[model samples]
Target: MDKRDYYEVLGVSKTATVDEIKRAYRKLARQNHPDVNKNDPNAAEKFKELTEAYQVLSDPDKRARYDQFGHQATSGNGGMGGFSGAENPFGDFSGFGDIFDMFFGGRTARGPQRGEDLEYELVIDFEDAAFGVEEEIQVPRTETCDNCGGTGAKPGTETRRCTACNGSGEQQNVVNTPFGRMVNRRPCPVCHGRGVIIEQLCRECAGQGRKRVRRAIHIKVPPGVDNGTRLRMPGAGETSPSGGQPGDLHIVIRVRPHEVFERDGTNVYVDVPLTFVQAALGDEIEVPTLDGKVKLRIPEGTQNGTSFRLRGKGIPKLGSQTQRGDEHVRVHVITPTGLSERGKELLRELGRELGESPSEQTRTFVDRMKSFLGNS
Candidate 1:
């Protein structure tokens, strides 16, 4: 069967940007992944198709050739699964590391890895979510010992290389089975993979070269940060046991509910109460905003639920220049109550002048009811 067009398979246009193609490919690949859809038998084939489409379009040269000659440009290449040593047949021959590497920035060279990353949740007020705030927090973590200076030795002592593993930090084990002879390697037990042993242990940290300490970290919260927003602080996590790089510290944000304003993305919504007289005969009203109170012009016949927009009055956009959303102010007309005798008399006179002529809204409702009754 003829293969589908590369752009069509990835659900992208011919003029689609590289970033657009990447995003589309990631979404489709993640959705049709066989592991995610185990009940579907054809999910593997679907994922393979998405992977092939992504592989061709992601490369500039391949994409240009495919665009010029369609599938004929690469028909000479064997079936997608040409590699003999592939572990996964449906993952574009790269297994599951692609997604993790793309999002997590990938790992470093093969060796003793750094410490594990740490995360902490922080709940800030609505004002803080809109505007930035500075906070000092205490974090309990592992730090290099002050006594041994992370060397695990006493003041005048030194460290010696391990003889068992020859300072290579690994031990190889050989086993003979029916298949063949197999060799396995693991961290050396002596010196614990550090390749060195201290003659005299440090008194403060007890030869661990690290100690538990409570550190004070100052964080600068940026404006317009929403819930689930993660902030990364480099080298703020636990120190590596092998003296490598320290992991990062992640801060998750949780914004509290506001009393008057409700935020959706960048926009903000607020309910502004107005008097009946003001609704009938237009008036200027003051409404609350993030910056301050602003005057909103209430046009004549502004009924309940009428909304006005205040441009550039909402929350600021994250990592943008002077870009902001508009604030929507919904009018809620308040009825009169607890009227004095004089006020009642004046209302009675006004009611007589207006007669029983209902407003346009009421007239439309009556017409709809009449139409329904007639049809019934």
Candidate 2:
């Protein structure tokens, strides 16, 4: 039986562009993928057909040949997995760059390209996070060479063309088969595909046009930047081998844990322990803030877990001077523990005078529970 038309199978028009053909194939492949449709036995076959259709229709020369000779032209065109051997029915590898870039993301080739981005972690005190600070950081990196103007040549001489590729930068890889000819294009390994070689090397950079150096840079950290925040320093990363533009430097912030306070977003929370006497009698207590020690008044009969809000006392909002967050102080009344003999005796005497039992609250709770059970 004759096979289905490739364009109709992929649901694309004859006039569809290469990009449109690829998009349609990807959509159909995803829908009919074996992993997505495990119950359907034909899913694998459908996916294979979609890929084959894409491989043919996406190429200008391949599509022209198939249009004229039908399946005879693509029968042995080496169209990946299906055809036996017709690899290079067409003869150019320029179109394959986009396909490779889509899958590997620039990993296949690297020359005269920018250096990879770098990340640095910086630990700062809480005070610095609350109130912005300017700091000097020593960063070790490679920089472009000043001598020879980063051309990788000696003071007066220039580079020479590569004999392997004749300065074309691309090396044609031809595969001969009984069905037809196939071609694969890649960077020429010799001379690194730049189509040139440095016959005269630079004394300063050793012909690399870059060298390692350590430099100190002043960075201003914004206020309210919490841990895990990133600050970008453009063009501060390692230098490229070919003296290309430098990559970016990312500074990741790490806020040190404070001894007395914890941070949640812009709000600062602190647990303040107070004695029972102090909570009952109400006293002015000293509390620590980012600025300095400040007095906080505790109301009489203040209960445990009671929170007090101090406006404009927390960390300043990033990039704004007029706005600030609040600080919450949670009161935790502390009960006396491990009392002395004299203290225990005085406490017992006072309890008897006040007609208070040592387990007054607990006994009252038990009594309430009994009444509830009886009612039930």
Candidate 3:
């Protein structure tokens, strides 16, 4: 069959950038991969064609030559520059493992593997999140066996080389394909890719080389860590079965909501209720903060919903000991209820002295609105 144009095979323009070409190739390759489309008899051939196209277009020198001379520039020995036919089709393909691993799992080799990572959700008080706290947590995980010193073999005996693969830990099978012969390598079934066999198993771990136990771990909760924040502790996860480096423990934080304060990022917000007299006249009132109660000055003629800022009174920035956010306090003026006759008369007299009238109040409100609109 005559070969299709490289650009047409990848469904990209001749002027497409390298990134665009790569994206196009990856999309089509994943869709037509033989393992993904098992029912499609021609999926493998299509994938090979896509790979061949990407192999040429992705290389600057090959692409420049092909642009000038077409397919003849890359043709040699019934292949594209010794990359097809009997040669390994993936020999020059960069990042092949990144795409192929999704379909074929991953490469199996003889070595110690890292342990599995674990995740834990920790619920903490809002104040604890604002000001850093040290917490001790109990985690149940697998630890290296003490009996055999993580070797899986009994104290006196040692592990022997795998008889099935002769310590290589890999088994190869020859596959005949349209391109040519392909060798598929997989882990040895008998040794499970360990390359060694334990003759006398450890009595405590039963040859697993690990035992399950609960351990107490201390974690430092940094300040300004809001809900859903994640903290990673390395080497605090399950022990490696093959005695390799351990994995990590991931902690997800959940901050309990405060009754009086709300947090946004490092900033803190709170609503303080003030009596009508306090809002009309100046007063010094105590306000709650992350540290403790602090006195804030309320200016005379303070209106409802007026916000005041207290500097350096909010949550500390993560990793910063001195830098902190400001706390915003919004005042809500409360109207008095069930007033006494004497109180009502005194209020009326005060209103008269202030020249309170319906028309005057409307005009004043209108003027304030106009001033606000003009400024805006």
lDDT tens string, model 2, 1-376? 7778999999988889888898887677667755467799988678667767877887788899888888777774344325433443223324444443443345355556887787888999998999988899988887777887776678889788988999877687666633234445677888765678888889998986666678887899998899999999998888776557889899999999999989988889999999988987899998887778789999998998999999889988888988888899999999899999998998789788889877996799899999999999
Runs off by more than 4 Å, candidate 3: 16-27, 59-61, 72-103, 108-110, 153-162, 167-170, 195-200, 357-376
Best candidate, TM-score: 3
> Which residue pairs clash within candidate 3?
none
For candidate 2, give the lDDT of residue 244.
71
- lDDT tens digits, residues 264-366, model 3? 8889999999999999997999998888899999999999999999998888998897999999999999999999999998888888899896678889999
TM-score of each: 0.64, 0.71, 0.81
Candidate 3 overall lDDT versus native: 0.86
lDDT of each: 0.79, 0.79, 0.86
Winner by TM-score between candidate 3 and candidate 1: 3
Candidate 1, superposed: residue stretches over 4 Å from native? 1-112, 158-160, 198-200, 339-348, 357-370, 373-376
> Lowest-lDDT window of 10 residues in candidate 2?
84-93
